[model samples]
Target: MTTYAKIIVNGSPITKSNFKLHNINGRAILPSNSGKYHDRYALYEQEIALIARNQNPDIVLEESLIAILKVYYKSEKRHPDTINITKSIFDGIEKSGLIINDAQITRIIVEEYYDKQNPRFELELFGESEYEINYSINKKSIIDNPKLYFPIKKNILKRDSDKNIDKNINSNKNTVTNKNICAICNNEIKTKDYMTADGGKTLICKKCFNKLF
Candidate 1:
């Protein structure tokens, strides 16, 4: 029921302390000035943006997520714990519009390693969904079955259309007023709720297509 994605950076991992907070007029404030972690934050921002842009179906969010961490250190040195570093990481993810809030994370798995050469943290954000798993299996089955292949599918559609000419005529009149039937689920599909594939031939509802394809 879990789906995850990995995050990689061109440079080292940014620790919590690397983000500075100065007291301006007796109040703690976060400044946008460049610092040692500037490069790292830039990379984080770019990576987050990349992930957000290429979301599977480009919409829908998994309410519950779990983040697994593998922090790689360049050398044997004292640093903040992975748990402590999580706040900044989660904040970056949210800032990039990945999740509604970091509070949606149900669990955390943290591990550290000595990388000596390449210093970076590997983050895997897992989403809990049983439907995504089943959808993958079903899609694979459809691809593997030659008898139920797309050509056969088109023939089946043709046969069904031949038998439903009167219904089709009536449905066409109401399509604009009622709902556009989804090609996949045969359910009433709203314009925004349906996605088209194969240059507009294959239509699927958002609920069935959300981040699965």
Candidate 2:
């Protein structure tokens, strides 16, 4: 299904070169004005920010997506890298709360051509179920070696076998020390992807978090 948050920004087409970081006493950030390109990116951010503001993002994806970006150009000049353009587009989408994170996207498709009149971009999202790795299956692939994706679903042990379980758990509590792992499944985060819950410090992966809230 072709479903996505309807977003549109009207302005000169932006490019990756238009984005550059500036340092203000050791804090790095997007520069306000460094060149025409930088100025254009600044404008792009503003336009996107306005487009994303105040809209309730209701769609969540447990799998990856097909992001088809059709970029229309005013001239035949070589454009910046498509990857950079994709970044510029979705970073704003994530910040605006359209979805949990952009890394949830598995495939990116870019189509470039001239549009002397009405130069702009068209972005559409599609489910990536046909291509993305299945979360539960990938995680628990080893059937012989059992591991827990979440808390035990049932108490399978008899009372006698459960005697030392609490002690063993408390003894190795700190063995796996990355606190930012997914609270639900305890998996190491895949990328600089993933989002925080609405009003909590807990982190959740897209597959797990999308099922909640």
Candidate 3:
């Protein structure tokens, strides 16, 4: 008997015959060509890689959920928006016998999008207590789903506080350095030099300072 691990994407079961796996340096790698929705599946592969590299077990299942979401999005092409995408991903993972808590999954999605510098999709995972997750293309259906929205007002506040703390720390670091040399320009800092608000500080040589200032 040959033993093979079953791969499930977005609530759909994928078999070894339909997918190809390669081992690179002891890591399991799934080729982008193994699935019809190669683009989305590739994202899944990347997510899995990130989870493994980070050693985050909490998000391992969520990564799988994302894989399924990509597959579903490729097929449905509409409805439920990002929230629904998350819900459907969770549902599919649950049905696949993966053990994961709903709240945990929600937290992961919230952080992933929140931390992304340039997100491809805009999803306000934190909002009203209730909203719809429409799986249909109809705008009316999306407007009607009550459970689509997850209340994340508190999470947003926390993120703000975290940002403020980081800003303060960076500001203090710059103040202590007191080097006004423009990081972009190769200049030296003198005792009487002044640094600007930006990382570049004015390290005006007495001549340049007298000329410019």
Best by TM-score: 2
Model 2 RMSD to the real structure?
20.7
Query: Per-residue lDDT tens digits of candidate 2, residues 29-117?
Result: 44334332234555575566557554434555445676777887777755565556777777666666665688977777778767777
How well does each candidate superpose onto the true structure, as a TM-score? 0.46, 0.48, 0.20
Worst 10 residues of 1 by lDDT: 130-139
Question: What's model 1's overall lDDT?
Answer: 0.54
Q: Model 1 off-target regions past 4 Å? A: 1-3, 17-29, 34-60, 131-213
Residue 87 lDDT in model 1? 66
Per-residue lDDT of candidate 1, residues 13-36 (tens digit): 555444433221333223232232
Clashing pairs in 3: 10-68, 79-134, 80-134, 131-148, 132-145, 180-201
Ranking by TM-score: 2, 1, 3
Q: Indicate the worst ten consecutive residues by lDDT in candidate 3.
A: 195-204
Clashing pairs in 2: none
> What is the C-alpha RMSD, rounded to one decimal, of candidate 1?
23.3
Output the number of the lDDT-best candidate: 2
Worst 10 residues of 2 by lDDT: 161-170
